[model samples]
Target: MKLLALVALTMCAFAANSVLNRIGVALQGMDPLDFATIRTGAGAAMLWALVGLRTAPRPVILSPKRIAGAAALATYMIGFSWAYLTLDAGLGALILFGVLQIVVFGWAVFEKGAIPLLRWCGAGVALIGLCVLLWPTGQASIPLGGATAMTVAGIAWAAYTLLGRSEADPLGATASNFLLCLPLVGAVMLWSGAGPMPFAGVLTACVAGAITSGLGYAMWYRALPSLPTTVAGIAQLSVPVIAVAAGVALLGEPLTARLIIAGGLVLGGIAISLAARR
Candidate 1:
């Protein structure tokens, strides 16, 4: 029961980050680069505070692995922020997850992992679904720029997750990665512009970074050990659904027919792949 509750909450937190990004970037008019900068800084501060409170080993920020992690994190933060400017929270979440699955399995193939045929078909289905979602209908399909940015974000996130496998202390290393990413993200933000940041936007960025991202990740890591490997993987498939529902309820984003069909295919495909791992 506790595990179920924990997993549910963690999924909500993960979804909330998407919603918050939409709110910050779309509604609040926060510059995407500024939001990313604030988010990275806030997440870094919160995570480092948690690590210190727990008396964890001091994080190593300059290591090659840490630098790589930071680079991936920077890419994810920037691209994710840029994507929300035009993307509905639900659609954005779905795209991010769809591409994340693609990258993960692509890497598996690259490493000569023995992937099942079913998984390959599943990946194909997911690709089809993403295409359908992005298909132009002379209507409200996501803009190409937003979709492309989200795809990049998803790829970076997959890389970050894969890199995490080598970490000795997940929490500490994550904290370090957060810290190490600040400069890179900041530089990108500067390259873009240092324009005005709204108080509300900053608040949303802080909430997303500290609460949804930092604490949420910590809770996920805590629950991950208790979960079956299959469960852990399958459980994440629920995040996009949660984000879609929340986006509709909170942000009044449309629940389009196209989105429903494509979301199902993408999620179903990933679910099929995860199930085959059993």
Candidate 2:
């Protein structure tokens, strides 16, 4: 029960980061790139601070591989923020997660793991649900730029997860990845002309980065060894649902019937997919 609760909490933290980004960028008028840069920079600093305080010897080593892995982290941070600037939180999450699942499943297959038929079926159902969730209604034109950015973010995160699978110490690896990526993030933000950030934006970005992204991701790594690839995929499906609720409750975003129905299908399909793994 405790493990399950922890997993749920971890997912909620992940979901809340999205909500925070949406609130800051969409509602608060903070530049998305600025948010990403500050969030990652603060997160990297906080993680290293904790590492310094802890006397444990580092369990992960940096190499060329680690540098490559850091690129994915950079992509996720930058792409996600850029995407959310024009996309709804729920829609952005749906796209990001849909790609993530497909990538992970493909990686599992390449590793010679058994691919269950039920899991594929679940994927199909979930895909359909995602289509419905993303399908624009009544002349609501999709933001092509935002959609592309979100897709890139999804692919980046998928790569990040797969990279973690190979690391002996995922938490240390993640921290190191963030540390390495921060400078790159800053450069991009500066190149994009992101100016001085507002105090409110800074606070929100730091909280999202340090607490939700940093610690939440570290905790996710702690739980990963106990979870199968399929289960991990399914567990992540909850993030979009949680974000939807947060959007409605905190951001005053309207909850439409379509979102409710589509979300149900998406989450239900993910549950079925994961359950079939056993």
User: For model 1, how does the per-residue alpha-carbon lDDT over 1-278 read when each residue is reduced to its tens digit?
Assistant: 79778878988998898888877888889999999989888888999988889865686778899899889989999999999888766568768877776676667668787777776776676666666664445677678999999999988987876776545676787788889899999998888887668899899999999889877766675676564332344456567776766877887768889778977886787667656655
The TM-score that candidate 1 achieves is 0.81
Q: TM-scores of all models?
A: 0.81, 0.90
Candidate 2 backbone collisions, by pair? none
lDDT of 2 at 133: 70
> 1-278 in candidate 2: lDDT tens per residue?
66677788899999999988987787778998899988898778777777778777874546886787779989999999999878977678888888888878887888888767888778777777777776556878779999999899988988877666555665677689888888889899888897657788788899999989888877776677777776677678778877877888887878888778878887788777767865
Clashes in model 1: which pairs? none
lDDT (0-100) at residue 33 of candidate 1?
Answer: 93
Best by lDDT: 2
RMSD of each: 3.5, 2.1
The total of clashing pairs for model 1 equals: 0
**Candidate 2: where is the Cα deviation over 4 Å?**
59-61
Worst 10 residues of 1 by lDDT: 227-236
